[model samples]
Target: MNTPTKRRGCFRNGCLALVLLPLLIFAGLFWAHRSSQALPDRFVLVVPLSGGIDEVRNESSSLPFLPSHESLSLQELLFVLNHAVADERVREVLLDIRGIHTSPAKIAELRDAVEKVRKGGKKVTAFLRSAEDADYLLATACNSIIAERGGFLLLDGLKVESLFYTSPLGKLGVQVQAAQWKKYKSGIEPFVRTGASKEYLEQINALLDEFYDDYLGYVSKRRGMSRSSFEALINNDPLVSAKKAQTLGLVDGIASFWELQRQLTRKVSGKELARDNDVFVSGARYRSAVAWPQKGESDERIAVITMSGMIVHSAGEMGEGIDIEMLKNSLDAALEDKAVKALVVRIDSPGGDALASADMLQMLDSAAVKKPLVVSMSGVAASGGYMAALAGKTIFAQPLTITGSIGVYALKPNISGLAEKIGLGRDVVTRGQYADASTPFKPLEGQAYNKFVGASGEIYDDFVGKVAASRKMSIAAVDSVAGGRVWTGSRAMKAGLVDRMGGLFDAIHAAQQLAKMDMGKKLQIILYPEQKSWFESLLQGRSASLSDRFAAAVKQQVLHELLPQRQLTSMATFYEMLLTSGQLQMLAVMPSDIIID
Candidate 1:
């Protein structure tokens, strides 16, 4: 057939495929939606936030989510927590943070959610066989925090770490090319050089100082002490003993499990209970979500979009963390709704995908045009993660919240030398120039390297310009901190990077203030999309097509294993993850390294 005839045939097929796509999508959504309604006879709200969200790196082992090393998503797992809230048949709420797994943000989120349930007249008893930061944070949110008689209460302050590679790379014939507009744009230096450059050290020390300051400040706030007092206690401060921690007002009181449970039951002796919060909400909540009047609600509306988990390029939250498509769909849906007057963006991430970050920033810029967009920083928001927040009307980061790292970087490993050494090499044939720009078959040339660096510069420029316009700061001011340099929420606020220092609840409050609502007025928060059911989880693996499983496996391995990860990286992935409210626990390191040596 001629080219025109083939094109015509292809066009005809495309139209038919388009027609069938929506029907299939609707059918699947409906099925999934309905399936969630089916509940079990007894459901235990398993809120295990013992570890931080693990990123996908090159893997040596399978099943990172398995028991040996379970990377729990305290954000996504909030559904299991729903079982404890306002349930008449759910006699009690059990919090097992003893064998903890979580980032401070997840710990805080889960803790707050648990606290809310306790406030709703339910008995919440947290049992920690031993105590760690994971146990302590969640314990504070519980009605009763029980520890083993001689268990420890590890409430130590935040610690920062970095992996220096400059020295090691030199021993080998490896060459690393690094460039950026700002002094801190040393994200690539670590791969080729060991030890940090003087400038890198200065920048990191400042950033870490701020991070530590914020952590101390926030812990003080939670513990009902002044930041000064907390700092005074932190010099050489490892909790010598749990008794000392108790004396220092780090915990309410130390008690055995039985005693803790007894106190909780007594305190919760009178309130109503249920199997799950759904029944309680159905039976006795303020107004039925089902009720509708002939007249619509007032013109006033607020859109809350959550950016959760490690942001990636694909499906936002289907099987993995933040997917741009998932978030873009949510943003588009909310924007299209006339009732949505403004948007509250919840950003939670440790950053990923520089290109993805820029794409999302464009999406946010588009959304901002139609409605006011405010960003809420959860836990650690850095690098490409913070890039996504630039388009918001205002950005909120917790005092201890990690922010900054407004930069772009890309790492392409060259295995050509290894292949040659092993006498196993592959040849490439390209139809056009630059076809091998990023291929692993050979080391990048000056031309290719220059091209990549230029691209990164363009991205960094874009990042600064957007921030400058959004925050109304000068280009120079934004440049000072834009080169993958991180900062604390407090420091960011001072630098105008973050608009306010606050928590999720505080973020909601700030959003309400922006919307001009009363301080005490309750704004009905509409969570994005919805959580999937247990059956879906069980069937999610079952329903996976060969392609889906293959994709998942690749992602799991590439991100978790093959991918050489650093502490703070990927501005793009961070932003997307915030949309889904997933946990991302990244290592403690600068975006890149710079060597003064």
Candidate 2:
């Protein structure tokens, strides 16, 4: 028989073993997973392009072990493609396109990257399943385009739809009194009229024509066909079957995903793949396994600041829109840093508050005076977005970018009828004549209306003045292009509003040249207003509170249940416009909301 002390020691040892066993197993598995991340000596890198591609990666999950559903960023994808160009282990790039959604400008950038990979002696193939026009455009850049059997290719032509809220708002006893700078300042039309005005339709049609021509021209030239022939093919069969697409020379071949994989294996390794894991590496895995090349041995740095979304005065805790305060802080930091030699500002906004835009323009102008500055316009940069770009020594935009709506407007809502309908009453007492002028219970009239109009006109004049000074044009010349007219990037370049037709990398190269840095040498690129992790944002109280989240959820549910999708979207747009303008503030927003599909 064992002694009591021996028995106690045995029990303690058993408990310790139980706890340590799981820990040891977990550690072993972690190491195994890490080791498995290594790339095969010769493998095809599968890059999945799906959903919305953001400009920067956002960390959604706080825990490393948890799965993340975040969309991949263009920068991340470009980085991967650039690295693959040099990595000998990467035999080829297989782009798996599945309902990819992004701007045409981004698609163009990606297409260029694909061509670069091919030039680097690596074959790039695109695999499509139920692809659309944008998806097909990107695939055209690949060496060969393969589609799944029974898949459909939707190549419908482009059309823009503008929503009007005047009738519905009138039904609800709400009237929006608006003042616009000129005829083309049609941002107010949607709220004031039932349909698009002549000027709006004219500009929109021109944009569509340009986009259609460019799309047809690129696809035709790439596929070694005449533009007229390609256009006719699209017109005849807007939605063609994968087999039909192959017959029309749109795709190279049709095969099942498994068959494609087998073919790729044979092409790369000269034999069919015995195991999937041994021959193929995912883009995510490759990103983690391979290290990015180090920058050249230099102390110089180039700071890249992205001003996206609406230009707001401040983002506060919500972190929505392009916060001017955050941007100013980043600019100040870059200006103070001795290592930072140049700055490239990437803007993708549809404009917002006039004052905020002016502040941004001023800040950028000051920075430009101190150092080399270049502006890169993404997707839509109009109105106040254009205002901000005036500070750049040289501005760059893609051929399809929507820009230039240089005007201002002011709107005030009169809800007295609604209050009456809802049986609400209020009695106001004020010493000043205009103290109650901003109250929604009363419509702005007489002196109040005059004051609002005067302020808006002044803002508009200031906008034109800034443009004239920046573009080296006469005030009259700038005013001619002003009046809230939107222009495609190519048109903007022709109008002297943009200096170059290029993308983000082109702007960076221009900055490097201006800074007198080596053209071939790599420099440290620092992104402004660095993205924060979800946990970090929460710790800093930037994430929404529980109450706010609940309120937003309830509001969304109520709207979805009450209104049709189209009407709800229009209402939401109107609400956002109101929020952006605030009370008695002039707005330099786009003439109309535009989304290219």
Candidate 3:
């Protein structure tokens, strides 16, 4: 009620208002800045080939909107290299080879792609911290090859070793009960027996020998070294010292990345860069100072379908990447598209979802009859990977392509004895005599055991029959290689399973050939996961930083893992590994082999 108290209250209210007003203003400025950040206009492409194909994410999904300068996808790498050869602004290519991992098939593609750049009157230089034999396969294509100071280049003979785990399973009381349908179907060998089977070893040895020969031949061609000399170098791989590597003529020079950069910018217009990352915004959206030449859209209108990652059973929401239902929808849409002249199903999958593969193949068969359906395989196309290719009018594979595994096996853990050891037993009552047929909780009865084996036999039979008809081989010939088998792309070609040994562009050309198109005019092709547009970016907030993004991704991944699913599986991790050529991948798959949707 006093005048002094009222004045004090008024003073407090004004100060509080002052503090809140500035807070609101700062928040608005931050949002506005993110939305209207200066448009990036220059790009320096640094191609560091990383793992597999990654889909474009929304701004929140991928942040800072940096045009990808770090690691380029196989396709993107080719495009940039192609552009550099002719474009004046794309002066030089700085390729880093520290973490590049790829199969032999992929190695060939990169080598050829870079070689084309050199042929086009462009300068290409490669800087590697440490170079392996495989790394050299790619770097050899570059005009100038530089290795870090004390960085060793050990381009030696290639080795492919198969891992066998029969003894481990035996110690753990694991029983691998199943069939051997093909002479080389050694996928199950690691589970049941120690070391490679005589049948499996024979095929592996033959294939490894072929791959080694091809590798040495390629190095010899690029390095201009004699075959005898190259053989001697390979036998003495893992050079004792970096200085020695240069002395032996295995490397052009040994210097750090900084020295390499100093040499690169010697005649450039702008300031010399200190680091590789600063040279080009890694994983950032490219906005060139000179207008980015708009990617020419396909006018010829050829259909393209993408098969990505390990093909596993389609049950949950299309997890992380590839999904069966998502693919099914794409297939249906492509089949219905009128403008698509023919379909090119690009398969980079290691193979998953046995039933799904069959279903997808059927869709391809339908599309092929209507128009040319060509298959373009990258890196890998094995087991289910090969199965999907069967749907093509013609299949294109890289020479080092990983393919073939034309067989099937069904396995379920029988832990009944484990339960007994734990003083627990499962009892079941069923109206049907064989209702408990697949109860892994209990031991298999004589009659139930017979039924399980018989069922697996029927499924394997169905698989072989399809292979015989698709490859146009006799039942006998097909059987010779159809049991839970595996084969490299080169071997698959000789076996008459794959149509040709080539790349994606080759597959596109094959499509043109199949349709009898003119060679002089460039062809238009339709590809899946259509590139994102700038319009989408303008509407959303700027992409977040890496730390913020990683936190969000972890949250989403955790929720998906803990959620309920309507499917069954046995050993989710093992299935994924089988698909990815022994690369360990873990999935929370159900306990039985079934697809819910």
Tens digits of per-residue lDDT, candidate 3, 1-597, equal: 666655565367678788678668656754664654333233345666544323122112222332223344566555456556655555667777774555566677778778787887767777766777667667778876777797676665555555555576446444445444444555555556676667766665665676678777877777778877888876855553567766766667877877766665554436666554234433233332212222334445566677765455553523534566667777677667765667788876666656667776776777789888899887667766677788887888877776776765554444455555667756677898867655545445687667655665675677777788888899789777666455667677888878888777678778877876666675555556454343233334258754344456445445534552322222344544443342222121111111100
Give the alpha-carbon lDDT of every model: 0.58, 0.80, 0.60
CA shift of 444, model 1, Å: 2.4
Candidates' RMSD to native: 11.7, 5.8, 7.6
In the range 131-195, model 2's lDDT, one tens digit per residue, is 98878888899999998888989988667777788998888877788889978988888778999
TM-score of each: 0.66, 0.86, 0.78
**Candidate ordering by TM-score (highest first):** 2, 3, 1
Angstrom error of the Cα, residue 7, model 1: value is 52
Q: Judged by lDDT against the true structure, how good is candidate 1? A: 0.58
Best by lDDT: 2
Cα lDDT for residue 186, model 1? 61
Candidate 2 weakest lDDT stretch, 10 residues: 564-573
- Candidate 2: residue 343 Cα off by (Å): 0.8
Q: In model 3, which regions exceed 4 Å deviation?
A: 1-44, 50-61, 65-71, 270-294, 315-321, 443-445, 515-525, 529-572, 575-597
Residue 171 accuracy (lDDT) in model 1: 47
